[model samples]
Target chain A: MKNAKLRLETCLSPAMYSKHANDDNIVVVVDILRATSTICTALHNGVKRIIPVSTVEEAKAKKDEGYIVASERDGYVLDFADFGNSPFNFTADKVKDKEIVYSTTNGTRCIHMAAHSKAVVVGSFLNLTALANWLIGQDSPVLIFCASWKDRFSLEDTVFAGALAEKLLASGKFETICDAVTASLDLWSLASPDLNGYIQKAAQKGRLAAKGLDDCIEFCHQPDFTSVIPVFADGDLVPVS
Target chain B: MKNAKLRLETCLSPAMYSKHANDDNIVVVVDILRATSTICTALHNGVKRIIPVSTVEEAKAKKDEGYIVASERDGYVLDFADFGNSPFNFTADKVKDKEIVYSTTNGTRCIHMAAHSKAVVVGSFLNLTALANWLIGQDSPVLIFCASWKDRFSLEDTVFAGALAEKLLASGKFETICDAVTASLDLWSLASPDLNGYIQKAAQKGRLAAKGLDDCIEFCHQPDFTSVIPVFADGDLVPVS
Candidate 1:
């Protein structure tokens, strides 16, 4: 008998992850409004590794150990962090060849949530194509896990999950019975024509814009902006180019 | 200053309810594939009250106490249940003037999740207008909580939330910063033209179809099929009409 098609599912929040978790699936953790995007950009710009911690204090302790830290909460940089949750903050000058401890209001925590999966990978539009290609080659079921805002569903991460699910479904290698995946694909179709205009209404968009940190909003939604895929390995996210 | 617009939000799953929970919000628990639809139908047909229990044992205990039970798990009628999770099974002949002890895989569990809210109401496309009109007069924030399938996002419930939110927002009496609400509105727009066709792709559609229990699929999507709004009071869901 022919092998069953690989299943592709989109989990809209970390709070819902327990239902979708599987030891055999490759978990793609996405935080489109910037944590995963920052990880992709940092790896693409030659950062050695990213150590994702769930708590701000953990990132702070890593800072005390002289490791650079990138932290933010509620759309603002923490007072003691070297940088906030922005892709531009991870450019080569600061993060290159250095191990950075990262924490955010949502995303890094999701990485920890998926820490027990067989494989955990960071995803954003910046690494969309590369990540999709890598996932297709893995020959396992895929679960696109969105690092939703504060364990509540967030639009941008889910939209990105739709974009990635669309690609995966088009490859003829995946099948899904997940309503979240189907709804997300529908959302992707609606949002793809004008991502910027569509995302302007997102709650986080307004929050980030108010803090003048939304400059990366469009950049974060730009598919294939980078070729690096950040794979979780040995307690750090390292580039898989 | 004018009073703030009444907040409208969608809680996509019972698992995510804690983050969106507030004593100030009126919670509308939805289980669109069947549970809430059944509740609306039962009440419209003159069922005295519904006692929703979260577990099969509780429902069985209620049955032992001589109350009629309506129960299902997955997509079939439980061996001990007099009726399954289908609205058509709830006719005046069988259910009128009777009190039902109801339990289902997802919906009943969700009702308990919102039991502590300011008010817990039942909603489905069957009672869409009556519920919305009643909510307009309540002068309170509304949380449309979807009884998502097994703690994961389910498409039909979210689309129904969008339909209700559209009505609530149209009254010009409500506002929302919730991304889940925004996304649901988008889904409603996409699905409204062909709700049956759109929902045909839902996983539960296949589940119910396999059991020969999806005859009410179209009826479940029919807006305003009943005017009874089931409101939780004391320990039972009594008709508010």
Candidate 2:
């Protein structure tokens, strides 16, 4: 049901999340460069549940416990991990019904930061429309939390935020008085015409491109690639039932 | 001489200032709704120097000491203040040749936050062009610091940062890879065409409007209204000699 009273706001970085956090608001954690995208893809491809930890050491500990782990830091696959943060790494053959532990430089930290919200759901361009629809169905206000690059703004996450905010606003169910939301909506309007080209200017895109691991950049921005909504429940991300 | 190597960045809020702060950079403190704008107008109107205090209690103490004090909190003049933060209150007859103590809800604190930078200067649409020109002549990288509303994003400050950054970048002496800069520049591009209309959406505007104190909103965005760059030196804002 549409609720005109529900506010939509965007937190530009995870570091700023505390100011925007509300126990009743649904927080949408976004790390469109790869982490959230990978989570969405992993769940869609039949992964049972994923444990997201903040530190690489925690991920290693989870791995030693016999859990399949996917770890990355600064865009590189950890030597002890089974996979990096690429959505491709979570294909059905490798991840089907497996419980994977995931960690990244920025994304996973945000999911944990927003753990206190009414519901913390993972968002990526791949699940943009689906997440928006899910949010519209809920009664809570929506806070789009960008897992920015190490507490600094990341163009890709913000652009994806703008994309999702645009969808939410279009539903006529949400409104915003936040400058961050207004700015993101404008950024989305500007970047949506040529997303691949637009993302080329992102600092993260350059970071991943320099590492030769940006093959997933295009895939990450592919809207509606999956309809799965990864919700954090009891320390694991499982698709909504 | 122009240095292509010099990078320009925008810190969207004073809360996020430390992440972008550098001992070698020039930090331009901006609070476009009124505080910084009032500072520029105060200095330009021949106020000897303005001492900025962070708290209302500090401002009251300064007032008790016989210093002319301008104090505001949440868009209203404090009961003990001789003046509010409106730029119009600093006319030559009233503030000329007198040292005034100032405190505001957001901007003064930001001025203090960037005090450790190589240089901390005030920027507003009022001094946009002159501030950009002066920054181009400096050898250090630039950080545009926005005194956002209580550590949240403010559309007015980011838009002004964009306006200042646009001029700096146009000089060809500055370049930026930071997403905040790119986002600001894009916002400036969009907001430049209709600034008053653009700023109408700011949450701060609504706050000021509700109090009937929004008359200065148009005056605040009038570009290059004065060229008096208020640089912080030895605890006071004085014009560049």
Candidate 3:
């Protein structure tokens, strides 16, 4: 391991960073189901830009200026929005030159929480390898901020964090800072090589399935399906410059 | 293995039960750095009873009644207090038959947080098996409240929580409820069997040793050295009732 001294906090809630409050490291905010996944998909599919706002009002305000408004609440697309959290919505044709002002329940809120970090990158399974490679390229400490479900620990986020950690570990950097990170890696180790199969069977995925959002689950589990690394700069998540 | 349906959130913090609190299972509060270790040593050696109070004022009130006052601040014994957080201070000669009013930085606060729990048990490496067996006897869910460092995740507390999860898993009814518990159990698997060796070289233990607290480190790592399971009931921690 590279011993990069990373801090992997398990949630995107304000409560997680309210105590640590470090602005020196790279903060990769992950909301795997499905804001981050959607963002990576949009950017990867040639979306002009993504304006990640903290609230629906801000997104709506941007909408009046001709930006496509994408908002989701509780994992469902709001009736008035042009798009929801599905990756399929971000195909090349739909968002080729569009600017998306987006807001979601947990992921966007995490971007706000980590806005002050030295570098903020959006991460999901779709951009896992790219995010890890970028993190390893930097000497600064990395923090994997999991946008947990409603401020509590969620399996999917931690699993993504573990996958990230596993990749970083493969590069021989990034010491395990906390037991949670080590535990996450352990879970990831138990997972089959087919990452999508494992996530589709996860507790969070099961809950989504029960709610009849199996398509969203499949979309969220697609690994390396996108190559975009959404970096937050000046309060907006744009393509890494 | 027990399939007891153990929930990790219930174990990490008592705040989870704020809305629908259930005082059914045993709540194990762990502050492995010193508080719980000190209490375990105190009760094991011969302290008649230790009353864990939430605030210094409450501790002082108990002290006014002629009880021995033990208080800690910033991981050290407070000035004008009878003792700090060292387990060595809890020898049979010092605390035997004495009423102790105990207050520490984090452990007591956790005890108070878990006041609504059906039963609160103080757990540490010193009495891991005793605590686990008592929890197995109970019909309710076991909430292992890791009294983290100032309410943030601390490595020591998580390791202790992991140890508890490992023990529970061995009994064959404890079903992992949340990611946190599963993570803790995974950590336990990596660190146990030679827990003392693990702790002796842990980052926190190394820091403590630098401060000339190696004795406390050794004391805290003594697994199953004391068979006493201290149960918190009626505001006092006594042998499990």
DockQ of each: 0.93, 0.74, 0.27
> What number of clashing residue pairs does each candidate have, in the order they appear?
0, 0, 19
lDDT of 3 by residue, A1-241 (tens): 6343555444323355655558887888887877888899899988878888767677778777878888776667766678876777777888888888887767777887777779889999889887888888887777778777665566677778788888887776566545456656756776537667656545667666766666777667667876779998776778897
Candidate 2 structure, TM-score to reference: 0.97
Q: What is the lDDT of residue A55 in candidate 3?
A: 71
Tens digits of per-residue lDDT for model 2, A103-184: 8767777877788889999999998898989999997899999888768888888888899888888888888889899999
Off by over 4 Å in 3: A1-14, A53-67, A136-139, A165-201, A214-224, B1-10, B13-25, B54-65, B166-176
TM-score of chain B of each: 0.96, 0.96, 0.87
lDDT of 1: 0.89
Screening candidate 1 with a backbone cut-off below 3 angstroms (N, C-alpha, C), the clashing residue pairs are none
Looking at model 2, the pairs that clash are: none
Best by DockQ: 1
lDDT of 1 by residue, A1-241 (tens): 9878998988998889899998888999988888888889999888898888878789888989998898887777888899887888888888778888888767767777777888999999998988898898989999999998889999999899999999999899999999999999999999999998999999989888899998999899898988899998988899864
Q: What digit string (tens of lDDT, one per residue) describes model 1 on residues B123-213?
A: 9999999999999999999999999788988899999999999999999999999999999999999999999999999898998889898
Superposing all C-alpha atoms, what RMSD in Å does each candidate have to the true structure? 1.5, 1.6, 4.1
Q: Return the TM-score for each candidate structure.
A: 0.97, 0.97, 0.84
Q: Tell me how far the alpha carbon of residue B105 in candidate 1 is from the true structure, in angstroms, after superposition.
A: 3.6
